[model samples]
Target: MSRTAAQFKLRMPAALRAQVEQAAKEARRSLNAEIVLRLEASFAQVKQEVSQ
Candidate 1:
């Protein structure tokens, strides 16, 4: 990924944010990276589901 990336503003529940923060810490990745990883996986999963 490029250092120069588009910025997005997201609003989520505090509980969800906390959960993601915990996961990010455990995984040793930044919160943005964790969120991007998850979102990319979701798109791949949806594509697979649609093709099935």
Candidate 2:
């Protein structure tokens, strides 16, 4: 399925922002991509838990 991208501002703590930046660099993804990847992983974990 095709999806449209939406843009919004997210306010986060400086420490958390730094952590994400480091992880993004390590993962070789853009900051937005890193955030999306992490969110998808989190949702998958919840779905797996619910199914058990």
Candidate 3:
């Protein structure tokens, strides 16, 4: 799907959280948007690799 909406709990190291938050701020995007964009890109990369 081109769009996604889901709610779930997530747990991660505090350091990782800080890194993501920092990147989000630098990109001028909300924390959630930054994470979603990255996750989508990661999946696309894996799919491409598998197809090759």
Could you say which candidate leads in lDDT? Answer: 1
User: Which regions of candidate 2 deviate over 4 angstroms?
Assistant: 1-4
How many angstroms is residue 22 displaced in model 1 relative to the true structure, after the best TM-score fit? Answer: 0.6
Taking the tens digit of each residue's C-alpha lDDT, what string does model 1 give over 1-52? 5778988799999999999999999999999999999999999999999999
TM-score of 3: 0.86
Could you tell which candidate, 1 or 3, scores higher by lDDT? Answer: 1
Give the count of colliding residue pairs in each prediction: 0, 0, 0
| Candidate numbers, best TM-score first, in rank order | 2, 1, 3
C-alpha TM-score for every candidate: 0.89, 0.90, 0.86
Model 3: per-residue lDDT, tens digit, 1-52? 2346666788989999999999999999888888899999999999999999
Is candidate 1 or 2 superior in lDDT? 1
Better of 2 and 3 by TM-score: 2
User: After superposition on all CA atoms, how large is the RMSD of candidate 3?
Assistant: 2.9
Stretches off by above 4 angstroms in model 1 are none
Cα RMSD for candidate 2?
Answer: 2.6
